[model samples]
Target chain A: MKNRIVILGVLLALGFSAQAQKYFTRDARVQFNSDTPVEKIEAVNKSGTSVLDTQTGRMDWKVLIKNFLFEKALMQEHFNENYMESTKYPNATFKGSITNLQDVNFAKDGTYKVTAKGAMTIHGVEQEITVPGTLTVGGGAVKVKADFVVKPADYKIDIPGVVRDNIAKEIAVTIDASLKPMGK
Target chain B: MLKKIVLFLAVAGVIGAGIGYYMFNKKVPSMASEKSEVTIEAAQLYQEFEADEAAASAKYVGKIVAVSGTVLEASALEDGTPKVLLDTGSDFGVSCEFDPNTKHAKTTFTPGEKLTLKGECAGINLDVQLARCVVVQ
Candidate 1:
């Protein structure tokens, strides 16, 4: 009976591993908007990398800070040199998982509301955050769209008083990624 | 003398404001006119980043780099930005996102085609990424 149980356990592990699939994309887009009564600021980065695992509901995302493009060159310089310090901390990352994986069927084709909770690391600061988004599974692909607000102070990003009112206290962030199954 | 002094002050203030306005509204520089600070092959660049990210980032990131490699894949971003992947003999390739400011001679490429591109390195995220890229050849 013990041998049969051990055999069953091993078989179960193998089956789970075999069914687990990873989805990935290197062209995810991340956009952030900062709007105040005095001014409006927007920036975007298109080459974000992300990965998702079906079995564990784990997701990982990363984007290079210097990749974020601004319309005004001086604003971009101030952002990289003064604010983000992109050279010292070149990347921002999020490593988390879907909290309600049961709501979304990875094998089926439809849209599901999902919540992702994870640690977001920016400017060398890590903070836990929950983001609400929608996931659509269709035609051998998965699409993720999420909108969340981030406070610069929470990330230790300080804006000087000179342009304090020009920048928003809470910046709105949007993420869109279409992931495809990783093929062996 | 007071009238002349007041006129001088007004002229100086106008000049200062003009400089400030120009600086505030300056546009991002075009990559086509910028010189490449580092010219390295895709495999070597990827190897350096893989071996040591900080060292590679300090050496390459935020600088205009020229990478020559065989094209693995060419695709456009959802926002219509052209992106090309250069094979680095690894699972991930050196990725280049073309600059929208500069007009490219060609936006299409066949796999296995060799090309050199120059852009500002934005560090690695599984794959090294370059932004505001311009084709060298």
Candidate 2:
């Protein structure tokens, strides 16, 4: 009886460990919108990569700055040449963790609302941020969704006085990713 | 004579302003309509990126490139957008993001399929990224 109980405990530990593996996505969608009374500017990037470890509650995301596409060609050029300076800082990244890991059950197939805190770096500047998000685990996949706000001034992005009114100080950002098991 | 000089200056200024306005508003052509700036294999591009990212970016960034390679993976996004990944002998490879508006009906690129893609290089992270990709062959 003692040996059988020990074997059962080991099997349970292995099963739980397997569920703690990392999940990732190569094409995470990240969109940003700047809506002011005078103007509305927005861009979308679908080539962002993100990784999440369910056990450690850690997550990381990386996106190339040049991948953000705008509707207007001139706006795209101004974004890369004048504002974000994509040549100097080609990538934006976020490294953080899910603060509410205890509230999430990875094995369950349901949507869990959670908060994540991390440092987001853009244009060579890093800022600590906490964002509310949804994590859905279903069909052997993990999907994450989050909405947050970012300030251009915080990243030292300078807008010319002529176009200052055309852009907003705070930009609304949205992220959605459907991650697969690692090494898949 | 002064009046003629002022009139000439005013006319030149107006023409210049008009041209400036037109240029300012001009948008880049869609990738499907534009010509590829350069043609290279996916492996070569990946090698260059891995060798020196800055050098590779200087050569490929903002330019339309035509890359031919074998498709290692093809998947549709949650919103039904099609994406393809080419082999690069690394943990990560080149990911091509296609125009979501295009109809890819009945066309699926499975692994080990040969394809040529033209798009703008978006620089490298874990993989060399391309956007607005259109399949040529």
| Candidate 2 lDDT tens digits, A1-184 | 9999999999998767856498988889999999988877889898889989898889999999999988777888999999999999999999999999999999999999999999999999999999999999999999999999899999999999999999998899999999989865
lDDT of 1 by residue, B1-137 (tens): 99999999999999999999999988888899999999999999999999999999999998999999999999987778889999999999999999978888888888899999999999999899999999996
Q: Estimate each model's TM-score.
A: 0.93, 0.87
What is model 1's C-alpha RMSD? 3.8
Off by over 4 Å in 1: A1-20
Note the DockQ of each predicted structure: 0.84, 0.59
B75 Cα displacement, candidate 2 (Å)? 2.3
Determine the iRMS, in angstroms, of model 2. 1.6
